[model samples]
Target: METRRVIFFLFDQVHLMDLAGAVTVFYESGCCGQPYELRYVSPYPQAGVSCGLSFTNLEPLEAVTITSSDILMLAGMDLSKWNHADDMKWIPWVQAAAATGATVCSVCTAAFALAVAGLLDGRPCTTHWGYTAALQEHFPKAQVLENRLFVQSDNIFTSAGISTGIDLALYLVEQDHGPAFAYKVAKDMVIYIRRDGAATQQSVHLQHRQHINHQVHQVQDYIAHHLPEKITIDDLAALVFSSSRNLTRLFKTVTGITIGQYIKELRQEKALQLLKEGHKLSWVAQSSGISSQGELRLLAKQAGRGRLA
Candidate 1:
């Protein structure tokens, strides 16, 4: 198996987590049987980062070579104080990498660097919410989306603020391997495998899970794994040795949704996933525990109408 190279472009005052988060995803992605070679390149021999930290053993950006099979990531930094003249030298390198078909991406304000390289022109991109207007003002050709976790325009990807870098990295992993493999990595990391860039600020799975009820969580886990099973309040109550009525009350109190509603939402989500993967409507309906295609359509309509809430 050929190893893919992930080159991280480091610069002065770079956000450490933005750099480390994506690196960690690729590092752990080796479990999928494809190893990745991680390299950190910078315009300088050494680069000082935020929070009084510095990185050594960095390769010079001019010395690195990127290929089509490789990925180039630019870490976010203090864009307001960025010295455009000093960093303009790296623009050609970024353009060269992109021209070679390398997947180029940026986290947060790093989109500014990519824009300066002329790679974001006419592309759907996003940066930190606070900098979205500024990015649009500077790069008039780029379509800057607001509130998106990340945006992918062909091989060029740009992510929202700091922590969304991890989300973007996991997404890249999903693109490389598959959703199942990405889910495994996310489980190991104890983070939700967020949906694609079109999703809102938070995922449905992450939003309703911020509670401390063990029994409720157990029920949720069971529902998630058994989406195709005909689950009832009695069955769920039996799992946690509680009464149906009490479980219903606790589930609503904890998750802000009734058990039936949660099950319906889960089934609809699963149906959408199956459909996205090219499954037949009947098969998706069966697999997602919906009674029939008509019912799935009803659920889809409700979702589209925002009536599921």
Candidate 2:
């Protein structure tokens, strides 16, 4: 595992939370033992932010080198207030970053920025609800998708709005690590609930985890990592230091479903993701906790997803 750099390329008037959310994701992942060298660079010496806040003593974009393993991020700001000439200066740098195989990402109206950089050209990207139309109109070459929380096009990623940056970050963490580790990051950040009314391939583990119960989140984390194992209510209860009946009751009360049902949904989602990635049926079954390919086919059939064909 190489030490990948997660670079936040900042500018004046950058939204704080949009930057903070994604920053926290990688930072927490590092704390969780996935080493990501987080770096912040800006063309501006002093980066002005929302509500008169500012960051000083920051490294310049010229100082940091973008490599293929780097994750380059652009947090959004009001396009109208943006210095178009200064913004255009970033185009060449981002183009170079992409040409070198870096993973470029934009949050909120930053998709417009990426579009301005020509990174979103011919790529399916999204932004805040209000800007999707403008994104399409302005970057006709870029395919703008509406109502998506975030859209990933090959190595490029774009997120819908402010907090969706967090979702997008979680998604990236899952891509870098695994769903189990992303689940832990989300739970630790207390963002277990998926955004309502938006369609995302948000981790299946994020579902059935809408509750804030500490023990429930721990159990869900355990279930995520141990999905391929034989999970029992008694085992989960013991892990949380509670009686099986009490833990089961509390789990259902918090998550609105029994543990068995929750496990089934998680296994289904894992199987589905594995299938999408073109894993063989036997491997999918073993990794997703299914008894066999026969059970995997049955699970896919019950979900009306073409019987794993």
Candidate 3:
């Protein structure tokens, strides 16, 4: 297998986690047999990181020749301390890499750098939620999405905040090596295999789990674990030792979704996953607890329409 090159473009006062998080993901992914040649480049001889540490002996960005298979990541830095005259030198290099069909990505405020390069103009992108307003104000042409973990437009990708960089890197891994390999990498890293870029900042499972109701949580856990089996409201209510009617009311109040809707959403999500693993439609429906392939197909069609809307 030809090794894919991943290069990090570092600058002064760069967020340490934004840079290190992605590096760790890529490194751990390599342990699973994904061949990646990681490199660090900067305009300066050494780059100061936000955590009072520095990356030294970095290759000069101008000296490197980016290729089509290369992934060039721009690390987030302190926007207030940025020097436009000095930093503007890197913009042309970014454009050059993009022109070569290399995948360009930004972590957090690094989207600002891409915007300066005119690469993000008229593209759907996002930055840290705190900076989303500023990003929109500066780049009026860019559609800055709020509360998104990441956004991908063509070969350009942008992610929210510091830790979401790992999510984006794992997403890239999945895009390259399939979901099974990406899941293995995520498992090795002890992190969830995050949803797609279009997903909300928090997943449905995580979003609905912030309550202190242990009994309701028990029912949620049962549903998640027993998706392949036939589950009913009575079964969930029995898990919590409550009447079905009361359980339904409590579940809706806590999760904001009725029990039936939650189950349907879970089944649809599971069906999508099984399909991604190359399973047949009928098998996906069976494994995801959908009654038949026809139901799965209708759900998929509805999902497609939602995306288009």
Cα lDDT of model 3 overall?
A: 0.84
- What would the per-residue lDDT of candidate 3 be over residues 175-204, giving only the tens digit for each residue? 799755775677677776555445643345
Structural similarity to truth (TM-score) of each candidate: 0.79, 0.84, 0.72
* lDDT, each prediction: 0.82, 0.84, 0.84
Off by over 4 Å in 2: 193-203, 225-231, 268-297, 300-309
TM-score of 3: 0.72
- lDDT per residue (tens digit) for residues 1-309 in model 1: 687899999878888888988988888888656568999998877788876789999998867899999999999998755777786668878899999999999998899999988899999999999999999998999999998889888889999968789899988887788655776676667665564536543445555765657788778878888988889899999999999999999999988988888888878777766665666666877688888757766655644432221
Q: Write the per-residue lDDT of candidate 2 for residues 94-177, one digit (tens) a residue.
A: 889989999999989889888888888899889999989988998899998888888888889899888999988887888788
Model 3 stretches astray by more than 4 angstroms: 200-309
Model 2, residue 179: displacement in angstroms? 2.3
